[model samples]
Target chain A: MNFILHISKLDKYFDNLHALNDVNFDAKDGRILGLIGQNGAGKSTTFHSILDFIKYNGEITWNGNPINEKTFDEIGYLPEERSLMEKATVQQQIVYFAKLKNRKANWTKPRIKNWMKKFDVKGDLNSKLKSLSKGNQQKIQLICTLIHEPKLIILDEPFSGLDPVNADLLKQSILEAKANGATIIFSSHNMNNVEEICDDLVMLRNGEVVLNGSVQAVRNQFGKNELYVTTPMPKEELRQLPGVETVFVRDNEKYKLKLSNPDAGVELFKLISKGEYIEEFSQQPPSLDEIFREKVGETNE
Target chain B: MVKLMNKFKAIVQETYVNQVKSKSFIILCLLPIIAIALIVIVGLISYQNAASSGNDDTNQIALIADSGIKKSIVQKDGDSIDSSIKTEQQAKHKLKNDDIYGYVKVTKNNDKYTAKYIGNESIDGGVRDDLMQNLSLHQNKLNLSNNNLTSEQIKKLSNKPSFYNYVKSRSNDNKSDDNDIKMGSLQLLIYILYFFLFFYSSITATVISKEKGSKLVEVIFSSTTATKYFIGKITGIVLMMLTQFAIYLIMLFSSYAFLSQADFAKSFIKENSNYVHQIVSNLFNINLLFIIFGLLLGIILSATAGSLVSRREDANKAGQPVFMIVIILFVLSIMFQNNSNSIIPKILSYFPLSSYFFMPIRMINNQANIYEGLISLFILIIFIIGLTYFISKVYKGLMLQNNNEGWFKNLIRGVKYR
Candidate 1:
């Protein structure tokens, strides 16, 4: 896939500590790339470098070319840190961001209206930012990030401080931005949203990318032969089945068995077939969160 | 170009709206109102106190002299004497009078005239000087009559002479106050400008530095170059200043209109006429224009400069340079008012920071010509532009520093990088 934003062998240092070490990645059009890491794992530093807020030794190319002085107007950045003046009104703040992207307020006003409506912001534009709820302010920030219709939108912790309804509204907007041919890179600690929205994932540990690939591919790569059997059998009965070393009972009658490395799921199915009716017996792979922990050796949560 | 301009406009709008939203703007707007009210209340009370105090007098003196000599010595056409022995006596008596001031006794003896002046306080040096010069003329006349000198000789001696005292400095060549009413108005000019510039520039600095110090600078920087952002900030500040000043001017004019009865206000309006002439004569008093323009240029330049070093503690430090300049410029302005044509101040006016003082002094001193004023004004304009540009260049990098160490290194780094 062609990447809208590509960072090649990026290196960043602060004093003695290497903040980002030889990081390489690509964020393509029409997709949300989830960047997951523990706190202080260079997630914010990487974003800052890409957005030209920091000086680092690397080439960050946008649309197959280096980001020189001129490319600043093309990308829109929503930093994890809040940046709006609390004294300023919502309309004023959005207009300011839009103007920075080199568009007039009049031109961006209609788009702002659409975005605020889309985000389900229920407030007056004339009200100052401090007067708005945190969730509403966050939504305003999201609208500001996307108001210019940027080609590459970087959302750092966009779902932060948002309720489910508000988060869902933001998610819809993020998806809309993606659908409009803008590439999105979403960084958040909220794994549920990450699991739902991201198709590609990059897991970082100690300022290094430990895993990167399609989400399903990464998840499918690290897992055991799994089966879910819901039957009349209890936890003790499932454990006694041939080739099953351990059985985990879930929701009373539901049973999950772990087979030996050489053993296959065929044995578990045969044991469950003896029942008059087998409720749930299926092979399943590891989830993304489980795969993340397996690959990085540290639970993200 | 379109895109860049759009971005700049948006930023300017942002700055304008944000600043207007600030509690500071409201505070700034209130300052002038409070000042004007304070001045009016204080002025009216003082005027009333002075008016009631004006009736302190106890005595008067009558000058008795022979009609022929008094007529010859004092130029009086009729009963009402524009220049007379009685006028002089009245001035002296006003000095003596618990009911009057003080009284002077004038006597004429043949060709020579003798005069006596007595007062509680010594007569003002200026008035004393006037009396001595007239007495000296009377002595010269007596000498001319005794020596039997010709009228032509007397005319040669008595003719008003040209004042030719050339001052060629060790390094240069050049030549070169008021009633209490005028003096008070002039002093008011100093305090008013001082109060307003500090109010305006410090607020601008604080507001700009605060915005940049917080997270917003990065957010704003992402969409445009620092220059455009700087322009936007400056524009917003200018708007804020103009708003405050305009309000002040309105209050000032309103007070002038209402308090037309008070001596100070009358004096202020009288000086306002002088200000008009000061402006109109600006075409001739090129020196005045240069000084005013130089000060103006310096203000705008330093305002931007103050922003360059803007950070957490920078407002305090940068404000020092700005206010220090204001204090210095104003001190020179006051000193220049007294000397008007001092050689040193004249040269100082040609400079960037000091020139603001120098130009005005030269003009008021009657030393600077229109040509010189214009030349200095032009130079001042260029210098301010160059300095502002330099500051903005430094500001672009300074805006990135979050800590003290970063601020110092980045200040230099920004300059070096540029």
Candidate 2:
């Protein structure tokens, strides 16, 4: 069962402000799609439209049919602003949310311990949600979202408050869910996490899809214009070189060069290494972080 | 449809279980019972105090008069005078010893009589009044005989006219014997409905606002339709209210059953069986349907108010409109409970909000017929259904909203978005 969530020509208006404008994307099964943008870039709006939490002008369909109540049972969502019933114990909250997704408590109950262990949650099942730290409460919320084994998973800022260790644990769980053929769409401000985990990426800018493709493809579209080299070459000489637009010393012995044309990378690599073995020499397209900044900066201009 | 229903059932179960376990719910449910118990305990203590004080000999008064006058007065007002104290000296001795509450002395003149009541303090007003009336009557008898009036004339002059009261209504051909009891039961029903509407509506509003204020509603809305969720939540709250009412009824019946075995309760029940029957019979009728539908309207409107707020702290303020409405209906109902035939109450009897109070009162007063009650109930049901639908339409937009806009502004936005 390869489930695909296809959102096409989606438009949403909040009074006079256009929140989402003809946004289009697809999240395929067994893959994680990262939605990346700066603040107020319509990433949350896109997720809201997909979940049908707000009215939109276009169609969002699961597989071939329109998303409906039955589809919702197979879908899991975690809102950007993390919240859970503070008065409920961890076990009760998880079971209640799972039940809302149409999963039985008996089935969810036995799996709570395993999920708690997997997420490395610090609190026990009976611990009140409010008693736990913010990170632990988020972990419990994540467990609730995923416990029902939803075919379509949507998470907004799932890693915003997590420490490195907890973030890694969540990353592992997300990958595991992906391996189980879940179509997962998550929005995040952390480019490293997106680069490390996302199979595909979509960048929204002011309610429009500015960039959308597989992670590599989206990056490759910008070409391999960034170069790193560990050389004895001075920064001024590198700046004067053909196709070298800018050069900056990155470390004690390392230099980073930006190429006006990607082909300039081969020449720079040859010149920096002099056909000899170098300690570090690499040329690649800009990172997701740089691309995100470039795209957002372009819109800002 | 099955899946939708399943989700609806899940929401209802969750809402009911969560709220039923809350400290607020438990406290609210027990508050009335505790209050009722306190009242009963206080009443019992007061009654016992009165009974014990009644048994004290010092609470009795003695009268000093001629033997003939004493006999006539004792015959007129028995148990009032302490006949054992026959003379002023003996009464004074008993009073000095704190045995007698007071003493009254009667003196006769040529055409007038004087009675003085003496004690350590002022005599009991009731005893003083009785003594004065007895002395005056004795004087009247003596004067009548001296004036040469016959015994038949005195007897005829002493006789008083008889009087009786009756109430008639269009519903009953005969005069109503239990009008007072029926009116009392109607007032009681109105009060119960008011509490149910006010308390449960506020609860519903708070519950909805709590979810909306947080991000929880987004997650919930994703799993179910807004209509289903709203209906499920209202159903859950209504069921909880019903459960609380059931507990009250059970407590009441259990208390009754337990007390019925006691001699005092048995005699009381036997003495007021007709009143009890009237109260119980008033509870089972088309008025019940109006109460239920009226409660639904209140809960639904409060839910709408709850959905309009962007934060949980605003929930109480959001419920104010509904609270004011309930208060207004209660005041109007009480004001016209007896004057059910008036045009204002008649008009209000058909309106959904006031009908719960007025229709029952009118029916109990026989100012509204069974058909009129049923028609009012039908209108209320239709109003509830329409309101539920309208609120459901706007509920999704309202829940999704997260702004600090004024409630009316938000409501307009919600309608526009819908």
Candidate 3:
């Protein structure tokens, strides 16, 4: 139940602009923390603060100790930009990174092959990094990031350029790493993917944490007023009913409706059931995407 | 502490291996060796060719005259009696037919004399000296005759003032020769050091900036301090420069040894033995510690400046200060080539930037003693350490700045802000 990582009262400024303002968050030892924000929302800046790459007013600790060079010994960081030497071959690049982490060549050479195989990346070990396609290069970068089996992995926009299949593969790898007890932290604009793998997330708006909790808890806090209805009636009829906010006809002649209140659910059900034969009415908590939009929308207003 | 050392060593090793294996570095290192070897080979071939040609002593030329002074000219000019008189057409025909190397045609026009010399080969220095002497004697006789004086008076006038020039001591001449050799060697060392400082430091800057642009600096900084990264990078480039210098030395020594075994090369080298002896003696006799320490400090200083760059495109901006120092050093080396004894050169030799050029010159001129050189080196070492420490302090924050500002501004800000 103890926090593996914690940052409280984190603040950063670049000139006159405030970048991160008293942002507070934490992650458990074996869970994934999704950092969700738009461009310039301070996700990358938060990561930078934690890694000590920039000067900031903050307190960041891992296992009750202030972060330092030793913190990186057990941590892996994949920068938003590709951090690789293009002219160097795959073997040279991997060995260079591994050696920087104090991994011996004898141990790293075999691990490189094993990781490349697991990632299903097909290329010669001696091939230069620039010769590989973007996806393959990303896979190699990922291997370098994860090969050390670090206790904490911080991936900044890890899925930026990944295709769907590669992203799925990466998701699986991340899950496996989590199962192996590594605390994973990542920042992404893709809400669906974030919801898929993240147990807890912090949503930042204008350098401030507006929503911070487990995905399920945060969604449940937003409350459940959405219902999927399979009916013969037109979707407009549901919108005209009292207590209904909006309705959309989904696939297979089903109408997914958003109600103004959970109490309105009975009214909409009664309205829909009175007119046409209703197949089923199921209510569910709001999606993380809806919660993110709702929280970010308030700040925008 | 052990982990830091290990990371530094790994970074140095990686930089060394990557640069050493690169085609550009390999080619850059090899070019100077190849060029020097080609120069030596070309010099040998041309020397042999010049030796095979007949000596200038054997060539013959004719002197034609239409003046009353012709016989007197020939008698006054020693070694000129071998020439046979001929008309202008005959001389030209002989020259064309290879019967004569060249001919000098003398004719009287108006009241003065005009001489025209043409030949297939350039007139030799000894021949030209004798001809000028004979012509001066003839002009003196003509002047005496026009003054209504007799030949006896002219002869007495020419023979009266016989003066001899002599060196009071050979040791002074040898010392001067040794100084020339030392200065020459020092100038050469200055050029080589300038090349190393300017080229290698710029390379280091480019590498740093390129890594910065790609976010590799973030990855490296995570595991090690900025000081370690700076030291490792500079050390890596220093090792590269040393490797290249070592290879060039090997090539030079091996070539010299190989050439010394051949009779032609040996004889050719012997003809310029005085120069060769001076160079070899200066190489062994000069204080090498000054040169080594000076170069090391200069390169480190340049590398420290280079680390301030944030992007590869602005590498020139980052490296400009070092390049300017090198250019100033080169210009001073040239300006003070013959004036190594001056106070200005000696004073400049104590500075860290110009010392790489000036210290060696002073050492070669025998003006800088061991203690003086060592003191200068000590000051330079201290300066290098201070600059490195200062730059390391700023390097971490400087590298993290995306550098939307100009490189110079970023550099200043990084240093000031830190």
Candidate 4:
């Protein structure tokens, strides 16, 4: 059905401060998109603009139609902060959120029970939300987000405050939603989780897109200038190499070196072959963390 | 359109049900019943005390008259009097000793007579009536003997009327009673409506502020438009209030009916039946429609005030000024209640918050015509609609405002920037 959501030239201003600037992104059907940035880096602002929660100078379209109220029915969103009615019962809260997504109670009630079990939540349907622990409350919130089986899901920091076990459970839930052909977009400060789950990523820095592409592609764009090696040579000798710009100990015996030239690996290989005994040497592209820092760091400079 | 409707319905249902089922709501609903029970119990205790005390005063009196009028003080049929011979001091002692219900002291000079009654405190009405009747007879006999008038002449003189009072109309007397009833009933209606308006609006404010405080509003806004969310909340809260009010009215009437079933309360109920009917009928009339619309405006204002603060704890502080404004209007309505025909009250009837109380009171007093009442109502509705529209526009922007500054500063910024 061509369920591609597109956002273009999005600009949002909060008073005199620019919150989002000329942001662009897309989420194709059955793909999970990650939005990663430091605090106040316009990640949340972009989400708000796309959901139409705030007015912005941009266009957001679903299947070539402008986003509207009907467009929201197929979208499930969990805001960055936990939004809940604390005094309400567990069943009541989930039903209310699901109903907002245009699902009937008769259809949602049983599904909620099933989701509750899948999440390993101990409380019954009638238990008040306040009675549950923080982790349990988060699980219940996750259940509310997925109970309606929305075609698109947007979760902002869905794993915050969750223990490792609960976070794993949440990751599985997101994966199941993706398996069901829903487009998923989530923002998180945890790079490992984002790298593990996201097929495409859009990184923001100071209200501008610093990087946007698939995980492998973004890493490849940074090139393979970073090299890791284990050798008998001291750290000072590695620092004195011709094309080496920076050298730091990766560990006691391993050194991570950044090269001034992308093809420095060839020169280093010749040196190792001549006399120096090398235990291990490999040329590798930068990690997502390194690329993120470089992109955001460039903007800072 | 269908999705909007569904979202609206869902919001209303959840809001209404959650609030209605809360413990605070249950307590509020039960308050009127408890109050009515308390009133009945207090009334019954007072009535019982009066009944028991009156039983001790039946057919008891001690007469200590002057010797000269002793013969003239012959007791009438069914009269019981103790004429014990004692000095004035002795009689006072006897009265304190509970030896008699009361003692009457009589002194006669030539053809003039004077009397004073002393008892434990004061004499009963029945005893007073009997004593005065006997004293009058004694005086009349003395006059008859002094003038040497025969019985026939005395009867003939009494038959000739000397003065007459006649009135062309009794409408003034009836109109005063109607005015009293209408004013009393209208005053109560306005007080209750004002209280409900304030209370329900506070509820709305609390709900809004709490949603923001918990950071749930953004997610909610993403699912529905601000207008639908605001209207749904207002509708839900108003419906809850109406349900509460209906329960209170039922409890009030049921308590009345129960109290009236007692033989003692029948007269009290009968005396107030017309006023009760007047209040009930006026409450169901067009005046009630005005009050409802006015209450809607109050809720909208509360929503505006509530949106200023980002935390629930600040809700009361944020809404305090608006709440006080409503209270001031109520006080104004009550202060000028008796002056319904005066210019002050007439002018207040056209005002916004004041009209919720003033116009209804004016209408009840027959000082405001149908046109004025309708116009007052119309103004209130328009004001509310405009405010709601304005609030809806600013609500989304305000919800996104996570300012760390004071609420007033944020409020100013929201108004200017949003």
Model 2 CA deviation exceeding 4 Å by range? A274-277, B63-86, B104-190, B259-280, B334-342
lDDT of 1 by residue, B1-418 (tens): 7656666666556656666667877876677678778888887788787777655332223233445444543442222222333565456544444444344466767666777766564444544455556567667767877897777887787778689986543221221112332344345545545665666667666666666655677777776777777766676666655565577668756765675656656776565554444333432344434434544554464445454564545655555557777787777778666675667677776777666555644654457776776677777877877876877666656566544543345456556432
Per-model RMSD to reference: 8.7, 4.2, 6.4, 3.6
TM-score of candidate 4 chain B vs. the reference: 0.82
Docking quality (DockQ) for each candidate: 0.43, 0.72, 0.53, 0.71
Output the worst ten-in-a-row residue range by lDDT, candidate 3 chain A.
A269-278
Model 1: fraction of native contacts? 0.66
DockQ computed for model 1 against the true two-chain complex using alpha carbons: 0.43
lDDT per residue as tens, model 4, B1-418: 7767999999889889988998879999999878877877887888888778755533455666755455445354125455653567776776666666667777778887677887766765765676677777788878888998878999975584567777644344577667777877777777877787778778878888888777788778767887788888888988887888789878987888887898667777887777677677866787888777877778777777677787767766666656888888887777877788888888878887677788888888778888989999988887778878887877777766767577668777666654
In terms of TM-score, how similar is model 4 to the real structure? 0.90
Question: Estimated TM-score per prediction?
Answer: 0.67, 0.88, 0.83, 0.90
In model 4, which runs have C-alpha deviations exceeding 4 angstroms? A266-270, A273-279, B57-59, B64-96, B105-126, B142-156, B159-183, B274-284, B340-344, B404-418
Error of 4 at A20 (Å): 2.4
Looking at candidate 2, what is the lDDT of residue A116? 96
Q: Weakest 10 consecutive residues, lDDT, candidate 3 chain B?
A: B76-85
Off by over 4 Å in 3: A1-3, A248-254, A274-280, B55-179, B271-298, B301-306, B315-318, B336-347, B416-418
Worst 10 residues of 4 chain A by lDDT: A269-278
Model 2 interface RMSD, one decimal = 1.1
iRMSD for every model: 2.7, 1.1, 1.5, 1.5
Candidate 2: C-alpha RMSD to true structure equals 4.2
What is candidate 2's CAPRI-style docking category based on DockQ? medium
